[model samples]
Every structure is written in C-alpha cells, then in structure tokens.
Target: MKIFEAMAGLMTDLTAIGKDQKNVQQGFKYRGIDQVYNALHPLLAKHKIFTTPEVLDKTREERTNAKGTVLAFVTMRIKYTFWTDDGSSVSCTVEGEGMDSGDKASNKAMAIAHKYALLQTFCIPTEDMDDPDAQVHEIAPRAKPRVSDQQVEQLRKALTVAGMDEAQWCASVKIPSLESLPEEKFGGAMDYIKKAALAA
Candidate 1:
C-alpha cells in the first residue's frame, strides 16, 4: 500500500488531543510538543513509517545591552524525511525561527520546526487557528524605519550628558513617551538631540 494510504488508515482512528498550554496575554491555547508526539506515536507505528529530522543549516543573532542583558534569536532550516517499510521515502524542508534571552534559542527553533513539520504532514486540524489568506495584511503607509535598542540607549546617554530632561526631549518630538517613539522618527530625534547639544 502507498504510504499515504497507510497513514490514512491510522488517521481514521486518531483522537484529537486537547491543547494543554495557554498563553495568557495572547488569550489562546496551543498543544505542546508532548501532545504532538503523543498523538503521532501510535499512527507512525501502525503505518510502519519512520521519521528522521536533519538540520540542514542554522543562523544566530544576538543583541546585548550594556547592563549585560542579552537576547538571542535563531533561524534554522531543517529537512524531515519519512520512510516506509517498502523503501519509499518523502522529505520536506521547514524553516523555524525563535527568540529567547538565554542559551535555549537553538532548541526552541528546533522544536518549532519539528512541530510545524508534523503538523503539516499529519494535517492536524488546529481549530479556527488558521489564516486562510496569506496576502491580506495591513500595509504601513511607508516602511517603518529600523531602530536598534543600542541606538536608543546611546541617545538616552547623550540626552543625560546634555543635562536635558528625557521627558521634555520626547515631548519636543511629539512623542508621548520615549518607548512610544517610532523607528521612522529616530533619525529626526537624533538630529534634534545633536542640535540641542551644539546649542548647549
């Protein structure tokens, strides 16, 4: 029998696993890795399917604050291979991204990749959790400029050296708060600060 046909046979008896994890802020529930693997095991065994995952490539990015706080982000490209007892095999590639403050970013990315790969292959129905249209999204009138946290910190230091009150500086730029300053305004904000310093 074809691998898909055998898989379908297993799916016929598969049960829905409850989403046991909750994201309080997001107000949503999601299945964890344990749930996914638990749901997949019996089906894989029944269908005589062997699954293998390989890391094809990986990349990392990090941002460190002067205060010693660090944020790590990673992107990983992985390949999932499915083999049948008859020597037939199929493979797919998945890219996963994750960010964390510590050393677990790579592990998080790998978990994300595996979850997605299994979700796709098993056609796991995530009830009402899908966006049917990929192209429809709010487009900003202009590209939001990129602002680095380092730049923000530097600006704050410069403001302090100039004896300028941070609140007043933010107000001059029509920003209600420093944190609310948009990326596009960073250049203008910096220019204002430089002019103020020269005047001082």
Candidate 2:
C-alpha cells in the first residue's frame, strides 16, 4: 500500500520530460539517462522510495563491422526493486543491449536497462519524444549472381545461330557482357534467342 501510494505520488509530480538530447549521427531527439536521474532523484527522496538493481542474466560477444573494426556487443537482463520503509516493494525486469568498439558495452547496457526500468515503473510522461518504434532502417539489397562461363558460351552460340550480333544484344540488355547477365535472366535471354532463330 505504501509502495503504490509512493508510486502514484511520484507519477503525479513527474510531468513530461522533454527530448533534451539530440543524436547527431541519426538526427533525432531523445531524453538522456542524466535527465531522468536529475528529474527523479529529488522526487524519489521526497516520496521515501529507493531502488536496487540485480543483473539476472548477461551475455557478451565480439563482432567485426564492415570496416573491419572489432566491437563488443553486450545484452543484460536486469531486475530493479523499488522499496519503501515498511518492506513494501515492487520489481520490474527489463532487457538492454549495447554495442561499442571499447570496453564500455556492458556499462552502457546496464544504464539502458536501468533507465527503462525507472521510466516504465514510474510511467513517466515523455511527450513528443522520438520513439524507436517510429524509426525506419534501410537495408542494402543483396547482389545478384551473374551467369556462369558455360552459360555465356551457350548464349554466344545461340546468338550466332540466331544471326544476332553479340554487341548489339549486349547493348539492348544494357550489360557489359553476357557473362555479366544475371542468372535469373538467362532463361529469358535463351527464349529470345530461340524466337529470333526460328524467325530467321
């Protein structure tokens, strides 16, 4: 009962936290952990609410980026317990992930987990903040496999039988050479050659 009363009091006093920090690389605004702590610390003390964190699980791995830079990736599941003076408390568990080129990956992960736990537990209002769910990430398309050497030879023979110039056909297809033609287009190219041969 005391824990609920303290939570409700904190929630009433904690108004919307503005997006005070900008991610320069990604061009979005966010509320940093420091902002959350600065806003919550005094109010938490006022309400006689204190919290402790326990790391329930942790994992770390090393990965190489496209530029061959090695990075450490860490993920942690943390449980935070909010306690009042009379042994009244509530717990929240959350998972956080971080990646860095140095040794601070785990620290970053823990901070993220702690921040989320506090925000969610208190149901803090963050109006007009850029939500991660609203962001879109673009992935590069995979390169298509080119035709094999044998397929190139077959196309050349078909071109000869059809009385079509290799250069003209390549120009029409906008490819540098038959060898560069994608495997998926090989059947269509062969069908065109067969039609030309029949017409010739």
Candidate 3:
C-alpha cells in the first residue's frame, strides 16, 4: 500500500489520547510521550507504517532561572519521515526546547520534538488541547534610557518656537518632563514639534 493509504488506516484506528500526565509543580496536565507511543505503535504496525528521525540542528546553553538556579537548556530541530512498505513516505520538521538542572536536557528536547512530530503528522486528537494563553509569565519591565540634557534643551526650544505649552506637550507624550522622554521617542517628538512650528 502507498504511504497515504497506510496513514489513512492508522488514523482510522487511532483514538483520542487524554492528558494523563500531571505537572505537580506547575499544576498543568499534558499527554505524555509514552502515552502517544502506546496508542500509535499497534496501529502503525498494523498499517505497515514506520518512521525515522533525523536531527537537523541542535543548540545548548546554561541559563539561570528566576530562583537563581542554574539549568541546562537545549533546543533541537528534528525531521521525521514516515514511510510505508511500498516505499512511499512523508516528512515533517519540528523544533523543541527543554530545560533541565542536570544532564538530560538534550534527551528531553529530542523526546519533545518526536512527540510533536507524531502528534502533528498523524493529526492525533487530545481531549484538552494545550493553550498558550492558559499560562502567564511575569517579566520585569526594562528601563529605557531617557533623553539627554542637551536633547531636553533642544526640545524646550522647539516647544517654544511651536507656541506649545511645555507641560501640555509633555503630558501628551505621557512624560513628566522633557528629560523624561525616552531617547527612542526623541526623533518622533522633534518631527512633531517641527510640524507644529511650521503650522504656526
């Protein structure tokens, strides 16, 4: 049989896998890789379908978490090819990332890539699909450099030439003072002031 026929047979027999594994630390439930393997292996064998994995790219780094704990983070891009006995095949590439405090980061990354490859290739069904919006991350806001004293003086002169109130102009840009304007916004502010001066 061709790869498409074999895949159709497998999909017909495959059932929706539930999210049985729980992340106690994070309080989330997900379908484990083992669960996917258990559900697909028999159907795949019955349909004479097989798969092979190739690592396209991989990167590793050491990162410190919010708690100051050091961890090994690994990201891997993998390609999986599904084939039938008749030699017809299909392929897919996926990227996975994993972080671990110990030596298993790479292994975890590979498993994640494999899991997604299978899940997406076969169109596997899950009772409760994972949603990115379900989680929230607290990120510290970066402080932007404000305008220099010289730039603030330039802005004040421009404001005067434009016949605009300093406090009102600052309030329009949501800054307490001319010096409080972010450096990146200075150019736009100058452009606006120039336009106002021309209109005046």
* Among all candidates shown, the one with the greatest TM-score: 3
> How good is model 2 by TM-score?
0.65
How many residue pairs of model 2 clash at the backbone? Answer: 0
Q: Report the Cα lDDT for candidate 1.
A: 0.81
Q: What is the C-alpha lDDT of each candidate?
A: 0.81, 0.92, 0.92
Evaluate candidate 3 by giving its C-alpha RMSD to the native, one decimal: 6.5
Query: Candidate 3 at 181: error in angstroms?
Result: 6.5
Model 3 lDDT tens row, 98-193: 999999999999999999999988889887886679989999999999999999999999999999999999898788989889999999999999
Which has the higher TM-score value, candidate number 2 or candidate number 3?
3
lDDT of 2 by residue, 1-200 (tens): 69989988988898888887999979988889999999999999999999999999999999999999999999999999999877899999999999999989999999999999988888787778566899999989999999999999999999999999999999998999898999999999999999989999
Pairs that collide in candidate 2 are: none
RMSD (CA, Å), each prediction: 7.7, 6.0, 6.5
Native-referenced Cα lDDT, model 3? 0.92
Worst 10 residues of 3 by lDDT: 123-132
Better of 1 and 3 by TM-score: 3
